[model samples]
Target chain A: MLYDVFISPFAEFEFMRRALIGSFALTIGAAPIGVFLMLRRMSLVGDAMAHAILPGAAVGYLISGLSLAAMTAGGLVAGCLVAILAGVVTRNTLLREDASLASFYIISLAAGVTLVSLRGSNIDLLHVLFGSVLALDDDTLLLLAWIATITLLVLAVMFRPLLLECVDPGFLRSVSRGGTVTHLVFLCLVVVNLVGGFHAMGTLLAVGMLMLPAIAARFWCAGVGPMIAAAAFIGALASISGLLVSYHAGLATGPTIILSAGVLYIFSLLVGPHGGLVRQWAPGRHLEA
Target chain B: MTFALRFSDLTLGYERHPAIHHLTGEVPAGDLLAVCGPNGAGKSTLLKGIVGILSPLDGTIERVGVGPREIAYLPQAADIDRSFPVTVYELVSTGLLREAGLFGRIGRGERTRIEDAIAAVGLTGFEGRSIGTLSGGQMQRMLFARLLLQDSPVILLDEPFTAIDDKTTSDLLGLIGRWHSEKRTVIAVLHDFEVVRKHFPRTLLLAREKVAWDATQNALNGENLLKARRMVEAFDTAAHACERAA
Candidate 1:
């Protein structure tokens, strides 16, 4: 039974193995960015940016007929443009960043759906809205791996300034000229990660991997470092378990993985030691200072 | 005397409404100055202008001896988000950003300095604690520790002592005294006239416009204090743009 649960699914099928690797790669890069997004109070911004990439990918579909390279590039360009445009509007107008981003992403989503329907069948729209992770080709796998690599390297270089930006942006501004550059770099990483995530999980549910694990990690860890580590760990665990369960039960791959993450989030909310419901409700004793 | 900072017809504000009006002044190097004013007196705005956070709406502020990096700023405690998951050690270590630029390693020597700064502020045992756990006084002490590690030639503080306990206030004032003796140019926004009279030598008495810029004893005179209040009350909130040419 144990072998059937764990080993048989992967051993029996090449596509399952590819899906596993692809989702794992998506998790590794996206989780840390998710933690930062939560810290910055921009959790929903990730969801918005995910939706923002859809229209671009749709346009790419119209042009190249389901080409991975064209869709990714198109998504990157669209995501960045929306992020920048929303930032500009927030600065110039009365609208806050969140409101401006919400407006743009809604428009982008409608545009994407319209553009996709104009040229493709309902099945094609389904493929775009909910990705076929059971069929990740070699090129898509390579793209996921490269995205993970670039995210990790860029984050390593930008970690300190990014942390400073979250904790005390005014202090960062006083010390160096790198504050704006650091902020722009962070926004770029978010867009890059979301565009990559859209390929594996589709635009609709791609942010599930990005936001859920990070939100769950907040309950489990205290420091930023631990929180990010816990997020990545939770994401990997959910990816493996979700992929295996979906294989055994004849379930859709992407939604199953996201549901697994959601279950983990609920579990953390109930029992995590840091700020979980149990810890908040039950106090045994106070420690000596 | 060499000026540490010079303001020339400087106006700073938000949305084209001037907070600090056309004021011109020069602060000599190594001067321990107190910026004393009533509420909405543009005291904080002037400090921001000096720190280069807000550009002038009209004229210029020239730093004579110090660069932007050499000025350490302590913003009001209310401005910081206390719930961020950073340890005291991490927060204090950011003070060395000047020596250790982005991506530079924090060497053994730097680590020692961070510890010493924490110890200097009586936060030695609290290094592992998150900023969320600190009390208001402890948080102020922690910020003072960061300023200690900054080791800047010029320091700007905005309402640094508000809501802090007496012990912490005295402790931080002692640190400021040490900075003054070491020839650092220190400027602070203060509400307590007694503290200002006892500590700061030079004073800039302001109410959107310069009321008196002289010795603390003379600047805090009854006439000037009353005039500052009147000037703030007389400020035009809905007036059109200044008719004076830039």
Candidate 2:
């Protein structure tokens, strides 16, 4: 039963193998970015950015139909534009970040949906919206791997300043010029990962791989470092399990993967160590001196 | 004598409406100065200008010897997001950001310095504890520890004792006294007049403009204090923008 559930799928199907590899790449590249978004209180902003990239992806599709490179470039540009627009509006105008992001993302989503529908049929729209993990070519796989590598490397380089910027921006400003640079670089990283995820699992569910795993890990860990590691592990685990479930049950791959992450999140919320419902509800835990 | 900070006809504010209007002063190097003023008197704004967080609307703030990295600033506790996930040690280690930077290695000596700063702030054995678990006093102590690690020549404190207990305040004041003895230039925005009169020898009194900048005795005089209050109270919130002379 176990062999049939997991091993046979990978051993028999080339598409399943490719899908698993692609999901792993997405997990490594995108999940840690999600952790930062959560820490910065920009989880929803990450989601908004995913939608904001759809118009870009659609534009990419319009320019070169189903061309991975073109779609990725388009998504990158649109995502960055929204990120910068939201940042500018928040800083200069009376509108707060959430309000500004909401305004931009909704407009971007509408534009994206409109653009995709303009040229493509319903099947093409579904492909753009739901992603085709099974249909990923070698180039797409390579792109995912490169994004994961760059995201991890850039994040590693910017780790210290990024932490300071997140925790105490005023102190960072007092000490170095890296604060603003760190912020811009972080936004770029977010956009890069979102574009990558958009290719792997559609615009709508791309953020799920990023956010859900990080949030679930947050329930289990106290420190940022631990939380990041735990989130990556959860993301990887969810990807594998989600792939297995999709293979055996004949389910949609993208939603199943995100739903796998969602299940972990729910489980962690109930039973994981840090601030879990069980921990909170346990007798005498709070009263301890 | 070189001035650590020199503010010449400085105007600082939000939206071109000066919160501090045409203020001018010099802080002598190594002097401990207290910035005292009524509410909205722009004490915090002056500090922000010195720390380079806020640019002057007009004129200049000249620092003779100190560069941006050589001045350590402590903002109000309210401005910090205490819920952030960081250990006390990790937060304190960030004081070395100017030295180690983004990818710089923290050698044994640097690590020891961090440990010493944590110890100096009375946060020994809290090396592994998350910052979110710290009490208000502990958080303030951790901030002081970080400042100690900064080891800068100029220190700016914004209401460092506002919310902490008296014991923590006194403990931190001792650290300040040590900085004074070491001849570090220290400027603090203080609301407690009694604390200022007692510890700080110099004071700059403000009321959207310079009211007094002298010894604490002279700056805190009853008449000057009353005048500052009235000036702050009577200032028009809906006043027209001042035209630049060009």
The best candidate in terms of lDDT: 1
Which pairs clash (backbone N, Cα, C closer than 3 Å) in model 2? none
The C-alpha RMSD of each candidate to the native structure, in angstroms, is 1.8, 2.1
| TM value for model 2 | 0.95
Q: Which residue runs of candidate 2 sit more than 4 Å off their true CA positions?
A: A113-123, A283-289, B234-238, B241-246
lDDT of each: 0.88, 0.87
Off by over 4 Å in 1: A91-94, A113-123, B234-238, B244-246
Model 1 lDDT vs. the true structure?
Answer: 0.88
Over the true interface, candidate 2 deviates by an RMSD, in Å, of 1.5
Q: Which candidate's DockQ is highest?
A: 2
Model 1 pairs in collision = none
**Model 2 lDDT per residue over A1-289, tens place:** 9788879998998988898899889888877898999988988878788888888888888888888889899989888888888877876689988998899889888887787678666536576788988888899899999999999999999999888888887788788877766777788888898788877788888989889999999999998888888999999889899988887789998999999999999999999988899888983535545
lDDT of 1 by residue, B170-189 (tens): 99999999999999999999
